[model samples]
Target: MKKSLRFTKISVLLVAAISMSLTACGSTGPKGGAAPVQAGDESKLFGLSKTETPDELYEKAKKEGKVVVYSPSARANDAKKTFEAKYPGITVEVFKLKSNDLMDKLIKEQDAGLFNADVIITKEVSGAVGEEMVKPGRVYKYLPEDIAPNVDEPFRTKDGYANYLEMRTLYYNTEAYKSAPVSSWWDLTTPEWTGKVYLVDPLSSPAFMDLFTGMVVNSDDMKKAYKDKFGKEIELHGTENAGYEFIKRLRENKPVVLKGSGDVLDAIGKAGTKSQAVGVAVSGDERKIEDDGLKVAPIYDIKPKTSVPDAGYVYMAQKAPHEYAGKLFIRWMMGEKDGKGAGVEPFNELGSWVPRSDVKSKNAIPYEKLNMWTYEAKGFYTNSAKVRDFWIKLK
Candidate 1:
């Protein structure tokens, strides 16, 4: 639901290679432009909390009084309240911003030699999170040993584990249609939906941009979906593959392009709108159906996939002032050993899916059963610019 970008694959790999070489496995890099954290010697900055019990970390972190958090979701405030209620003496302060802004602020803080944030939960998987923050040693991955196993493998990463998986996919007005109107990605290119589909410009959103790049990388799936829909092999016109060709035909249909998910939803989600409009939206925003009284629902089984699944990730800050508090908060936020912690309750809403396999969502729909695919981060990181340009220059 959050982030911004423009990058390429070979360039991303090359830069990562150079950064790794310079940092010597992230042991020798500038700690956000402060002191160098020697590879094996970061224990002082790393703290002893990783190996300690939650009770031990909680006791130590309680003494610190508070932990600072930077996150893209507003729900962190709910977590903050529940956490305070559970722990009493300890407190959480949340800084809510878009992922791009959050990452920029973190980088700037590190560059300025100030390390104030104790924890961060945001998303920019292919761009700022992996390549910009984790690889540069600006953040650290902290998985509570007791709870890690409950998380699905797809949600785990070397950088850190995701707190929740979010879908960048299709949403339609329920008031306009009784059921899903489009059954495939290729359906959007058809004449029936011309000028009736709404999309957030990929150039403005990393999630949408990466979703397109993912299509290019896995264009075979797009080709197959195309043929299955139209009963003929697809033809590409000055494009890389069926992915670009899909974009071409969809663009020719004159879809309305907006600036954000909220805007796109607002355009199509109103009641009594005669137009049978579909919008590409963040699934997490599906809550608007209740919150704003918009009758929108996700098309969870769109052929070839429902969406490019991304996530909201939680990461510990490097040299955090309240390291123990940071670790304890992460443990709590991950829903503890059994996935019943109050800290995760606020996030167990209808639109989002938690990473913990043991945690059942409050809503009925199981995202695991939906048609979703794991996107390629390396390709998303680098080749997204190609997708962006294609959109920009498409006639």
Candidate 2:
């Protein structure tokens, strides 16, 4: 009986050994798939070498065949159509997701040794790029030499990525005001405008947080605006600076805070509405003035500043499966390849301002004419937590 039991145990051990060997053979690469293309070498084939021309890069990308991009914009679909049309052999697969969700998925997948996305097109420079991707080496900096010169300083980061600017402007009901009644940023905090202003809830939207942080960064301008409007320097009421003072006053004024810009637009822009609320909205939302018959117009010529520039940045994944294709797509999106301004159509449709000096803005009001405040991406990343906490406490 002992000999029989020992034989059975030996047979079971052999079976287990065979199963382990088969599993080892099956697990060929990270995440148990075919080996991913080795990256990190400075080679034209891998899209790291900047020496390759657009045409050469296109050829290499075509050989790679596909690029998978994750973006927050639905415009990615339009871009996909244009890119695929331009390079018939290559396929561009875009996954549209919220900025935070995209980052979370990327991080989770990266931790699991899964590198599915080749590129990320997002406006989350401070939160996602600065805090997450760059810190962990999940993304590689790859700026093509051909397109590098055209990118503006404000839109290009030190870490080697490019961004396109979108304007967040103050909007008022045209019928209610006839023209924009508010000239300065401080005008909204007054008795007449109190409880009449609308804004997207800052706590929920990083863009709104960035805008508030932008106001803080440009406290000098806010100080001047305060002095100009109120005829005296702003007195901080348990706040740090003029920006915070303005925020505190604005909050105390009982302004309507909504979930989204769309809701704000609907409330403030709806025709025949009795409320004369003015809200902060994107320039793209101006299209609704005609489309929705909304009696809203941007306070474009307001004193000190009319809008904050929201910039969108793109990055390549560190372990990009199709690195060459990713690089090609980036270049194509920046309008470096064809020179006929092929890549910017999707952005144009959405009324976003391109940061490339050579690309002219398609907005009714030219970018040069607007009083614009720029967000400091690095500063926003570093101080966002503090700002968020302060804002929450104030609220």
Query: Which number leads on TM-score?
Result: 1
lDDT of 1 by residue, 1-395 (tens): 13334334465567667555222121211233223344665332332123557788788888899999999888889888878887878889999988888888887887798988988898864455777676556776677556756777665433456787778888888877889999999998988989989999887777887777777777899999999999999988888799888888999999999999988888988877744899998877877778888878778788887777778878778768877787778878888888998888877777788867799976567756767767545556566667777888984
Error of 1 at 342 (Å): 0.8
For candidate 1, give the lDDT of residue 125: 48
Each prediction's TM-score against the native?
0.85, 0.81
- Model 2: which residue pairs collide? none
- Candidate that would win on lDDT: 1
- Model 1: number of clashes? 3
lDDT of each: 0.75, 0.67
Off by over 4 Å in 2: 1-51, 125-128, 156-163, 301-303, 337-339
Question: Residue 239: error of model 2 in Å?
Answer: 1.4
Cα lDDT for residue 367, candidate 2: 56
- lDDT by residue (1-395, candidate 2, tens digit) is 11111223354446435432121010121222212223342232122335456688788788889999999988777778888998899999989987777777787898798889987877763444543454334654556656656656544434435446676668888778877778887888889987888888887777777777777777888899888887887788888888778778888888888888778888988888845788987776666667888888777776577656666667777567887788778777777643345776677544466766677666776555667775555566655666777877876
> For candidate 1, what is the TM-score?
0.85
